[model samples]
Target: MKPTLNEQLRQNIRFTYNEALELIVAMGMAACGEQMYAMAQDYKIEMDPMADSFYEDTKARLSPHTFRELQFFFGHNFLHKTLDFGFYVSICSNPEPQSADDWIRSLEAVPAEWMLTEMVFGVYHDKLEELLQGRDWEASKGNLSLLAALVRDTPPHQEVIHTQEPLLECLAHPEECKLRYMQLLSQFYKDVFIRWKEPLKERSEQASAHYETLFAAKPEQFIREIHKNEPEIFISFPAAFHVSQASQVGNHFLNFTTAAGNVGWVIFGIHNERVFGPAADREQTELFLKAFSDKRRLDFVLLLKERPHYGQEIASALGITPAAVNYHSNFLFFLDLISVKREDHRMYYHLNVERLRELLALTAKVMLD
Candidate 1:
């Protein structure tokens, strides 16, 4: 007898995290933290002027080389099938802690061309051969910004013709840039993670335990049980990059990943459904109350509870524009109360019963605690 596709998919899921992975993720997050610099005052997180400039410089060097690279790092499901631009990281293998030295070695081992390809072609990696079948990269430097000049000098431009010279710096030396940036921030990384060591360890432990329970349960119930407010998850496999980072910021979750060899990320957000359960801390409870207080949001939730509906359909049902529905949908999505599933080009939204339940339960627990 043959197993079903879902079984095959479920077999791939694993409960895992590693110190090395966390370190890299932490570095990336730290790099991106400057964007939320203004919000630090709310948490009383000190904002250093010099640190802000440093993060800016770091972002420029580590900037994603391609659109696909950007999508992966931001933890979006956006991907192309030709390259498997988004592969599932937690599916096949469990992650184990790697010493700092081992992590450096792992970084060193990453192929230069592989990193370049991820930045340049990414989802369109399969086309790299055809795109540069016989072009001399060094020779085409003069035509950096002009596709026509490129075609005149190098015939290959006539193939998938276009100009993207700004990204050339990245393609030229991806490995060097990546390593240098990581090295530059090594001291800061060491200091920050060391300071947050205890919390990181606790969160990592909680994540591992939570996943253990989920894996032991039925696959069909996996999404249903994740968080009480989690809308019925209908996302495709290999599309999510789930990172397990223990941070109070990002609501204990954020989207981030760069194509680590054809894989997408799924952010478990440390405060994962299993680990933190449905409990919303003080800050989150305030946010939820404000978001949930709206009459429109209330109607939207009740509507989704009945069945999954696309933005336009939901809007028509609620007597609002699709854009308005989209806005509200995004808020619900951020709260994990709703999820999206693509059918053709349309993204259908449905209630996450688990998230809803968790939100209510946690709201109560938080109030009492």
Candidate 2:
């Protein structure tokens, strides 16, 4: 018999531990690389094969340094990509499935580009719902403002507004107006914008200080620097770099020499987070760093980790009210950290244990030291 979805996912995780890590890292860095590429594309910035060439040349010249930067870049990028994809998968795969084929088909059908777009829309929808429910939009106005700025920066936003002006004008009431505008606006920018843009923007703002510390002239320089400074660090390469040479070829060399083990690759590019299993292995390295952070809400994760328990069981275990647990659990489930199994009258929770273990190990190594 074929493996169950959970079982299959576990096997995949175990089988490709290094690859999975690589994918997570790749996903994270790609989030930045892709975002930069999109922005460059929008500005018609002459597509330099140099970035790819530089990356390769640097890797070859300074493999160590390039590796470390790649790893840092990947870690930073993975978390955002994972959470974004996780949320998208959760919403798209509603009303949990009973058969493996149904679930597999569901996974296969997820359009990565659309998934990212919908996730942005979902965030806007939730914010609008919150505003409608008496929450203050002004309190979170900074975020709203940023969203607006992101829309303005991307060319697609202008196109979306031009095309969707009618829809925006139709929902002109105060309660719905902002959201409608954001919804329409996000649609246009989604293709060009990545979830990691916010973090990258923050990083870019502090570029002069952080760049020398984080990025390398070559891959070997990255590895050697990490060996001298942060000996425990693990780094991975982006698939794009494997194909480019914008950096000095030697600078891009990777040093996987740490006694604690080195970074891994996720391989695939942007993908749907909900599509769990070996197939989802490509470019998922971004998840390792993002999921490791405390921002992921531990209680929900604990509930999922414990067992395939029902709502009340999860609530009781976490020492919270059922309604609260339901809200949080739903969010975690939405994030793809947990899965729901409905049996007749109730739903049970199952955590993605293998992924959890991988994340935990990486986090312990990176942060604990």
Candidate 3:
């Protein structure tokens, strides 16, 4: 079928998050998932008491199965992108499947990969070398048995596959274990989801209702007004992501969609709000003043007032890196002091004169009152 994402400009947009899957995935990735770690590398969460407590408690509750083999198996691994992994898209629907059966069926249907890609890194990297050394068929029984269970029909002798990061001794029988491993993960996900189902369901319902209402009324404008810099239609519906900057976004993803006909993405974000507070209280005049007290941000804002400029252009003019420009602009963007425009791949940042005026008025009102 055609993507049809651009056709219904309004109904396709949606917001979604799988609390259970996300939590498990977070823990799994924390062990060795590169992408997950990168997103969480920033922010000194250890300094935040609540964040610290949550982290420790969650860690303590983890079982060996949940923390090790299972984590590695279910989490992203050597064959992450290569296989039709069921868990990644398991909860991508409305009124998420209410029974474990849905997951079972999904796992059973996972497409197989012909080869078990080599694992480059992990706790077990090269651990197989010792087992494979000077071993006859009978002596390799332990290794063969495990491989036999994972892969169908084993030969008299098998060779291990090498990988970039030592993640795997060989890509043998990886896809064979898809169903059994999935069954295990399925139970874990269901139990945890049920235990917290009440709160998770309630949050989901309220959020769904809120989005339905918002999208029902001028859905196109909602996308354009809030995310002018994004595409009219996302290639993937209901996308998700995580962030270490809890103070910046709280416990919510920056969610929005175009064409309400169907959801294009659900950005499941790890807001990490369990750890901290907001950037600043708008009611606090000193906070507002302090926010703009940064000379670099102030200069960036002034430049936007003249004309729209992208991060790179702004960075070039300031004799700094583009990343520096993004860092400074993010502050102004969060406070609504600026607006963004997208033309193809390039993002143009513009100063919001009206927003500045409102803040100025609010500042005056606060001072006089």
Give the winner by TM-score: 3
Off by over 4 Å in 3: 1-7, 14-58, 73-86, 89-101, 114-170, 224-231, 234-265, 268-369
User: Looking at model 3, which ten-residue stretch has the lowest summed lDDT?
Assistant: 114-123
Candidate that beats the other on lDDT, 2 or 3, i.e. the better one: 3
Give all TM-scores, in the order shown: 0.42, 0.25, 0.43
| Model 2: residues with Cα > 4 Å off, grouped in runs | 1-306
How would you order the candidates by lDDT, starting with the best?
A: 1, 3, 2
User: Over the full model, what C-alpha lDDT does candidate 3 score relative to the true structure?
Assistant: 0.45
Please, what is the whole-model Cα lDDT of each candidate in the order they appear? 0.48, 0.36, 0.45
lDDT of 2 by residue, 195-252 (tens): 3334323322342233233333333332233212231233221111111111111112
Clashes of each: 28, 77, 34
Candidate 3 residue 360 Cα shift, in angstroms, is 15
Score candidate 2 by lDDT. 0.36
Tell me the lDDT of model 2 at 171.
22
lDDT of 3 by residue, 9-113 (tens): 444444444454444343343333343334345332233343343335434555666555444453444123112123433333323422434545554654433
